[model samples]
Target: MFISDAMAQAAGAAGGENVLMQFLPFILIIAVFYFLMIRPQQKRVKEHKNMVAALRRGDNVITSGGIVAKVSKVIDDNEIELEIASGVKVKVIKSTISTVVGKPAPANDTADKK
Candidate 1:
């Protein structure tokens, strides 16, 4: 006979090494994403939460809306009173505060004031 039978390729063992090797790139990608993106984002969120939690009176902050104000009073868990201008104030959500620009440093009585 001139035609020969086509033999099938041999299957790999079921030890799972081949499966792991096939998925190694995906696992690495996920790990890289976690380290490069997810972990840093979580860290930033934690830092932001801590910063917001530590917010108090006299802390100069910039709102996400680009308004510069001082924390005149922390009204409640979710709201704060901001002194946007002299004798002018406004209420805002706590998380809307973006950056604590100037934290009021404690005054040292021993130092001479010029």
Candidate 2:
């Protein structure tokens, strides 16, 4: 008896449009994050996969665990032998390695043994 039915219907339609506009900024922010942040991280992971697969023996490397060791032996497609110390070696998986250290120098016999 107090409010008109036609006015109430018009107000409901306008409120729905306002609600959708309020959510537009949030959707745009999520799209920006996916392209700028998430996509680059995924690409980096794929490149790291290729790098690990190409590793070979004699390539000095540092592990993700922060242990720097030379590639003493490549055991298989997934495992490798790391020489952390003289006569002290350890087995590490390919994915564990992070960076390749400087390459070893070529051996040259210049000095005479005493």
Candidate 3:
């Protein structure tokens, strides 16, 4: 007798959210992760692959182990000969190279561009 019947009916009439609205935050999080993290990582891998493929004799490179050396020979698809010092060459796996420091000057270009 003390409680109103309308209040009980109003409580029962409330509805749950739609399925899409329930999952919207998860979808937004995945989209942000792809754009902010995954995409840039893919781009860096592509760039590193290109740089590794373009390696040739006489290009100075820094290895992943932090050794600075000149590429003396490209042995095959997977290896290169690096000259760490005069007459001190070592065979290094191509993927171990971290960065190409600089390309050597062309052999045929004798005239100074000054």
Candidate 4:
């Protein structure tokens, strides 16, 4: 008669709701990471895909290798001919290009010389 009722004590203890509350912070942390890290990364990948798809001849671009060049020819879907210097050219894969420099404004200086 003096024995403790183990089954009654176990049934009365905090259960599923208490366990879920303990993990609530961990769930929130994962949600924050997805929005702040994963989402932006995916968006940038999409924008880069669009930029690469829109490549055309005469676009002044910088490559991932840090070389700046102008697109001399669109060889095919996979390769391009870049003109790095006058009469000097190199064949590079299309994806090797990184960023396109914005077109320069028209020069105000005239060709007339004294």
* Winner by lDDT: 3
* lDDT order of candidates, top first: 3, 1, 2, 4
lDDT of 1 by residue, 1-114 (tens): 323322222333355787899999999999999999999999999999899999999999999999999999999989999999999999999999999998998988778665
lDDT, candidate 3, equals 0.93
Residue pairs in candidate 1 whose N, alpha carbon or C atoms collide under 3 angstroms = none
Q: Please, what are the lDDT tens digits per residue for candidate 4 over residues 22-104?
A: 99999999999999999999998888878877788788999999999988889898899999999999999888888988544
The residue-level lDDT of candidate 2 at 68 comes to 84
Instruction: Give the winner by TM-score: 2 or 4.
Output: 4
Of candidates 3 and 2, the better by TM-score:
3
Looking at model 4, residue 6 earns an lDDT score of: 75
lDDT of candidate 2 over 21-62, digit per residue (tens): 999999999999999999999999999898888788788999
The predictions' CA RMSDs to the true structure, in order, are 2.8, 4.7, 3.7, 4.1
Least accurate stretch of 10 residues (summed lDDT) in model 3? 105-114
Backbone clash count, each prediction separately? 0, 0, 0, 0
> What ranking of all candidate models by TM-score puts the best one first?
1, 3, 4, 2
Query: What is the TM-score of candidate 2?
Result: 0.72
**TM-score head-to-head 1 vs 4, winner:** 1
**lDDT of each candidate versus the true structure:** 0.91, 0.88, 0.93, 0.86
